[model samples]
Target: MSHLLNRLTPRRGLLLIGLVSALALGGALVAQHFFGLRPCTLCHYQRIPHATLVVLGGLGGLLPLGLSTRRWLLAVGCLVALVGLGLAGWHVGVEQHWWAGTASCQAGGAQATSLADLRAQLAAGPAQPACDEITWSLFGLTMAGYNVLVFSALALLAGALAGGAPRPK
Candidate 1:
């Protein structure tokens, strides 16, 4: 069983990871579109890197490849997952009111401007999803918290892939 799993084509590995990421992303989009659970700017910002990583994973599988390249690609995936972890941690902190979130959410930034600016800021749009709003939760964990747990598992998979790679002298 282990051998069969390990023998999967690199492209397939890429596809599996991409598919997982896309499913999670699509789920979030669905929640936002259908459920109207708006996301804060920071939450959105945190997603960008993971999106990039998913794309990279797909490309890595397609490019001319070998064990070393595959290892590196998986390493990149691990790093991106870690990046997600950090952003999730920050979101959790904001949710806990341990810290204020982005500038738009608060008014004490160095760039907080005049009365017009303040008025514009207020009127700019609906309150960006508050980091602490807790739009969705599962098993008593916020989305960010869930992300940390799930992505950590993926990172471990990446590390295992690296360890299983053919060693060089």
Candidate 2:
């Protein structure tokens, strides 16, 4: 196992990150489109970093590059993923009520004169996705929790790839 991983060049490692990011993003999109699970504003915010990282990581993988470029890609790439992880973690906390979610995501915000007015305001907010209500869950895990898990795993793998110590096959 270590031997096989040790043999993967940096380009391969970056490619893996890119592919994983895309897959995760795509899966979320599918959930939203087909499963009727709409993402809240925070969820969109968390997704942006992942999407950006995927594009950058893919370019880094395919670009013929020198050592400096490789290092920069890995370092910056990890940071991007880390940002996603942080956002997802926060969203998970919000879902769990560990902290207050934005008033927009759920009810209990400042009220408008009419339901129509409140809905319109919510539609126009910074986080159009709403921070309060979760769209879906599995084993009690919200989408944000899943993102935290996946992004953290990706960050760990990226760290190992950056370390570049030859591992056993």
In model 2, which runs have C-alpha deviations exceeding 4 angstroms?
1-4, 107-130, 166-169
lDDT of candidate 1 vs native? Answer: 0.68
TM-score of 1: 0.75
Q: Whole-model Cα lDDT per candidate?
A: 0.68, 0.77
lDDT of 2 by residue, 39-137 (tens): 787877888977987887788788887656765687777888898898998888887778876655664445689999888878876334557577678
The 10-residue segment of model 2 with minimum total lDDT is 160-169
RMSD to true structure for each model, in Å: 4.2, 3.9
Q: What is the per-residue lDDT of model 1 for residues 30-133, given as tens digits with 9 covering 90 to 100?
A: 87889988877666866675586678667766677776777778778877777877787887888788988876644233343688877876676555665667
* Clashing residue pairs in candidate 1 (N, C-alpha, C atoms within 3 angstroms): 95-132
